[model samples]
Target chain A: MAQLFWDDVEIGMEIPPYKKAVTLMELNRYAGANEEYVLIHMDRDYSQKVARLPDVIVMGNLKYAYLSNMMINWIGEEGTLKRLSAQYRGMDIPGPALSTEPTMICKGKVTNKYIQDGDHCIECEVWTETNEGQVTTPGSAIAILPARS
Target chain B: MAQESLITDEVRAAIGVETVSPPELVEMKAIKDYARAINWPDPPNPLHVDEEYAKKTRFGGIIAPWCFYTTLGRSAPRQRVPLPPARVGMNGGNDYEYFLPIRPGDMITTTSKIVDIVEREGRAGKLIITTSERTFTNQNGEVVGIAHGTGLSQY
Candidate 1:
């Protein structure tokens, strides 16, 4: 397979989206890794009574990390993940809900030119939406792909 | 100090102070677990699982997936600006940039500085918005990543 070169990519291209269904155990592990001992994420009772949340919630950064793979997978081997910024708009609850799966879409030309002869920076608007199709985490990124001449 | 009050003069005064966490070696176990926790298993994400397979990728060895830097750190204490005393601080947003891959055995250290902090009125009443910038470097002193985060605080 040919590496994703600058010549191959075009504006308005869409990197196929990916989805992940979050779970409670995943939330707990994420908390432990970041040393984020916040009760709203780990303790259900505290989340419900004190924090006034529905249930244990997933960490925002965890969502960022989980969703990052979509961009990583899209850029392929020779490309670099230049930048990604996430604006966490909605609160995500862990557990079985029809609304659990979050999807990331890498869409259309944020920049007109993919840098030539060296690294071509493919920029795009990246986003994650809830099952209801409401945008949750809206972000952008600049992915650099090498010119395979 | 009252909940409705503006940010303390101290918080404003302490801006630009830099703090460095102790060095920590990136671990493959932690990387694997992070991938699994995200429900990213098998097929495509083999670099986090099969060591031999990772040896073949451009990364050259087992590596934590992208955005793993968020969870990279140790319990080492660092003295930095203190937040205005508030009962709750929520995750506001994150702006991250990657320079290089974090591989197993790479000693990762972060130097962070308080860039901005301000108080504003919101529907909830008063909000203290604090922003910080973290620069991550590997043992070779090569910059691996940078992350800027904004957090909101309320009483």
Candidate 2:
């Protein structure tokens, strides 16, 4: 994989749009893998009865993992993923295309560029939006990019 | 120290020490299983790549799927014997800071330290929030990533 060179990146650059469709099977697998059997992540009946939700919801960690991979894939290895901060804003319930009223959207906007301790880097304001356009996981990250020679 | 208190020296000591586990190797099949299970679109394509496609795509190789850390984070749960009044707590939520992208062929180990503790009063009862920092290192001992997550407990 070609490391993302700083020379190729543009200020205010926008990464390619990426989408991930979460499903029941995926939620089950995640829960099973983590041994997180909380009713909210599965068992629609329990979630509705205990949590008072319309249906079982996806785990917040699932979204965090999905968005992190997408950003890493976009940046490549030349750059390092410095940080990711997110909020568990909405519940992802199972359905057809656009299950929840708002589809989860992850976006990145370049905020700053500079070098620290001899390494060139860029700061980005990253966020996730619901299909309804509600910002859910609002976060930021700093990546070390190869210096343009 | 009162049995009901969550801030005992023993608990504090457990939080202070850092723990590093042996590296675990994750193969393409295990990763693909995660994708298939999550039903994440663009799965097999992102798993492996061809020359022609590699030219067009920015990501040159099979990118590691996200949440790989969740697996690494599960290396081992802190053993806690349930006392009559103080039972082990449930995970409330995690606030993670991802430092680097985990790639294929990379052997990652999680090194963690409990950073902080906060006690609070909730409608249900008292709760404790424990924050931990888990740094992922590559085979070369290079710190590739770091994650700080919070574990919550209520009794």
Candidate 3:
């Protein structure tokens, strides 16, 4: 991975989109890793019958992780992730109900750049959208990148 | 007739009450599992799973992914605002600030508190939004990260 320097960033620059096709097994794995065993996320029967949801829903925290990964991949090892925030505005279902192809698209746009307390800071507006173009999670992040100097 | 307010006096009093969790040791397996969970179909980032490669990077050793803290302190009891029962509850969102890298073998302690609770009339009828804050500290007493979470309950 190449080191991303503050000099390389410009306002309006967009981070390459990170895409994934969410599955039931993937959601189960996330439940094991995070210990979030909420029935709405694991058991389709419980999710649909008990919870009255359409199907097992993806964990909001997992979506948060996706957004973080997008920024981490963009910043590289030298850059530091300072802050990340998101609001879960919509719900996403995994597997066949959605589509066979990758549906979750994670994206970010650099919104601002400046020096703050000796740190070269870059702020970005980040979000995840379904293939249908509905923004499920919307958020922002701040990262510090090394300076060329 | 007006709907009854969910923010009772008892619920208001529960705000700012804090729960402190016992320290738990971070493990390499947990980190790797988390990395794999999020990066399914595609390989996880080497910085999170590849120890040999991470040794040469600035982190010196493999570090957990940015949101790994969400997995910590799960067994411990949490403080919840005393709101009236509602039909359904769901995760609203989260805000996280990372101050340090969490590495394997590090001990993490978490303190959580409900900061605010508000009621609103929604399309469904009534909604309760609970905002909470959690602080994560390492064994060295350094604050590694802080998370602000919002949970919504609808009636």
| iRMSD per prediction, in order | 2.0, 4.4, 0.9
By lDDT: ranked, best first: 3, 1, 2
**Between prediction 1 and prediction 3, which has the larger TM-score?**
3
Give the per-residue lDDT of model 2 (tens digit) for A75-102: 7755666666655555566555434322
- Cα error, candidate 3, residue A56 (Å): 1.8
Give candidate 1 regions above 4 Å deviation.
A1-3, A97-112, B1-4, B40-44, B74-84
lDDT of 1 by residue, B35-89 (tens): 6665532244777778998889888888787778777544435544556466556
lDDT (CA) per prediction: 0.73, 0.63, 0.89
How would the docking of model 2 be graded? acceptable
Model 3: per-residue lDDT, tens digit, B114-135? Answer: 8999988988678889998889
- C-alpha lDDT of candidate 3 relative to the true structure: 0.89
Over A1-149, each residue of candidate 3 has an lDDT whose tens digit, in order, gives: 68789999999999989887888877888989988888888888988887778888889999999999899989988899999999999998886643458868999999999999999999999999988989999999999999998
* Model 2, position B29: C-alpha lDDT score: 61
Predicted candidate 1, C-alpha RMSD: 3.1
| Candidate 2 local lDDT, residue A67 | 63
